[model samples]
Target: MSTSFSNLSELVTAVKAATDAILTTEPKEVKRIRTGGLPVGTNNQYFTTWDFVNGMIRDHSTCTWYSLLNTFEDERFSLDQCCALVHRFDYTFSNFLRYSGFQEMAVLAAALTKHLPTAKTREEAVKAVRTFLAYLNRLAAWLFHYFPWNIGKHLTYSYTTASIPTPADPDLSRRVHVADGRKVRLTWQPLGICVVATLATKENPELCEDVLRELPFSIIQDHAVVSGESMYAWAPVVSTAPVHVKERQCDAPVGRIRYSQATGNKIIVQYGRVTEDIETPILGEILLQYRDRLGEVGSAVWKSTFETKQIILLTIETVD
Candidate 1:
């Protein structure tokens, strides 16, 4: 019972538990972050465990300086490595990408998500580390040329679906059987719809338009012409917890824009760019370069069947 956490999963659980403590302790201060008009953590979309951790690392102010050190000791996640993960959210530091895992074989490049010991051998662990880093650097370069915004800022994913509410009133629609009737809703904060909308307003709006017109209709479900441009590939980020409100995309911090060790940037790029090509649906190529320890999961669950969804990995070779 006294054994320390031996894997990434346990460590992640501890980190989340610590952050949840903060939320439980200070509920109003978090609600105040909405700034009266900024549509975040509102409606059914509440502040997530990742959001608190992300806020702590964004700047020294909210760094949870007291508990963080203890958490570091407990989890054995180095302050440098922790900061490096935060840097991955830095648009200039790590190219925030979106891709269906199986299509890109991202499962092989799980170093970013899984712990190092998950690898079979030291050599494999080392390669996974190298490939993980190479992917970050090269991916940043690719997104810089392809999209207009910084990568997902301190992006933490939301649960696949929100909790289902109970039916006390027992009246919804009469067109269906009472026993079979239930509510249907989708949350998009993690889906990156706002990611696409924000990018549409970038410098070379023409490229986005070109990509839009030629989009394979088979890829999207429900889309719209946003900001007078032809934007596809996603539904807008909306909240459905208590009420419905249009939500804006979250922003990443610019603290460590470029890679630097002297600034205390601790991302150790161990491997060089081993892959030669980048593709939209941007899979297969990048993941092939890494060691397969814990791999990216691409089951039917993660695939987008909608009319428009945020395409995570956009490259010059992206479907045009």
Candidate 2:
């Protein structure tokens, strides 16, 4: 079928349909030719170039796009030239460069339209369809990496750890792959403290998180895995007082303790403790502001020892 795709959704939909049709009828329609260069009319079942491309996409999951480009390679090369130009000036494909490569595929799709309807011979028609379908497969790969809707055939989920993270019950608790682009929502039981964290990816090498706290008085810091590096950041200790004064006044009350106004004792909270060795690990500092009092504060810039206060159960879920 000769179809003109207006957008990426339309293009991917057409490619999926063509690939499904080709793969479905391949076992029944296809019969290997013996001692022949090309199957002529009535000699073999009629199969389009999309069938060949579908076979390659199914069989060779990790083959490069250049192999498929050979179908269109000739003395006066146009598709390969445009593809090289796109790769050179636009951007290189990598784990981080998904959308840029998808955009490049879209640009190539427009260039491929010029040669679609002009195929005269069977060989030329096969080359034209194969070249177009190959790039469409590449584009679909990028789209599926981020938002996977229908995972069938060759598409599958990748595991981050050796086993799934099932803390309490293996069957009840869920397993999450933070390495992928998944946003995890954690809700602490009993306290109903909710926090969200988007685990780091190759594109964005930073651990993102919301405010996590066991108690309002206890200082909370988050530790996460980012790009194979263990990183941590402390949540800002907010003051609940009405007014805050930065500088000390000349006539201010000095060495005076107000036992009536003080709410409670200062609570120290730390995460990811490090052990002492010949070469100690470099851990960052955390500033603690206790009970909204500027005078009662603590700073641990360079320290060899830290302590873990408590641990609690929490539920994790993959969110949008």
Task: Tell me each candidate's TM-score.
Answer: 0.19, 0.20
| Tens-digit per-residue lDDT, 249-285, candidate 2 | 1111211111000111111112222111111111111
Which candidate leads the pack in lDDT? 2
RMSD of each: 23.0, 23.0
Residue 301, candidate 1: how far off, in angstroms?
42
lDDT of each: 0.24, 0.29
Model 2 regions lying over 4 Å from their true place: 3-55, 59-80, 83-198, 202-320
Q: What is the lDDT for 312 in model 2?
A: 26
